[model samples]
Target: MRTEFDFAPLYRSSIGFDRVFNLLNNAQRLHAIDNWPPYDIVKTGEDDYRITMAVAGFAEGELDVTQERNVLVVKGGRADKQEGEYLHRGIGSQSFERRFELADHVKVETAKLANGLLSIALRREIPEAMKPRQIAISSGLSDQTAPLQIEAEKQVA
Candidate 1:
């Protein structure tokens, strides 16, 4: 089955979003029509994630994982073998391409293959400046101020 997406109305209404619209206009990317060696994307923590792909009959050496231009590309291809006399060949050993879109600041931490599963862990770190900080408020005017506020101001500066 094939699914279709219409973005004409969205594009028409969108203003000052040329970059976004251009990305969406890429039909090839907007529609991912292939699913081989199904995978899963799981969020393990507030800033951590994991992508697990079911890569049965695929060896660790046969698969390759790389991040380029913020896109995670997973590719698999089996080594060629000489044809032998066989009555049946049920299992398939074919090449496949799987792509994933990543958010800004997200990066692949590590990749491991175990128990027929290819798992890639990702982590996004929040910069110290971007992290949430508590602000202390004074109840009344006093000659001496709260130590926390002084520390906060120093950090900000």
Candidate 2:
């Protein structure tokens, strides 16, 4: 059983949240129930993050990692190859793609594969102009007691 949410009301009242609403709508539409090759996300630091996925039977050449705009995509699979028949197969070796939504300014730093794990490192690099800074408030002419007066008596015809 599943339920769908209506975001029309929120769109009418909210501002500067179009992305959020779009993400919610996309999530509802995808509704993917696949959970193979389990992964974990962790906040390594204030501006750093990490994603680790367990891919027991995959190789470096069979995986791909890419980021476009605010989305991170990780795909794993290998080209079809004939091999000896196995008496009993236990490992999961199938094509899979995982997507991650990243906030603004968040970028992928590096990706590493070791033992049976794939680790992706991310960092938030906000631009200098976007980072918060102290503003200097100044007391302008408002503090002056006398108002300026124009002297035009000599030029009067």
Query: Which model scores highest in TM-score?
Result: 2
For candidate 2, give the lDDT of residue 131: 89
| Per-model TM against the reference | 0.68, 0.85
Which 10 residues in a row give candidate 2 its minimum summed lDDT?
Answer: 138-147
Candidate-wise lDDT, in order: 0.82, 0.93
Residue 37 lDDT in candidate 1: 82
Clashes of each: 0, 0
lDDT tens digits, residues 1-157, model 1?
7555676788788787765655556644555557678889999999999999989889988999999966899999998685987698766678998877776678999999998889999998777898899998866655476566443434544
Q: Superposing every Cα of model 1 onto the true structure, what RMSD results?
A: 9.1
Where in model 1 is the C-alpha error above 4 Å? 1-32, 135-157
Residue 123 displacement (Å), model 2: 0.5
- How well does candidate 1 score on lDDT at residue 127? 78
**Considering only N, C-alpha and C atoms within 3 Å, which residue pairs clash in candidate 2?**
none
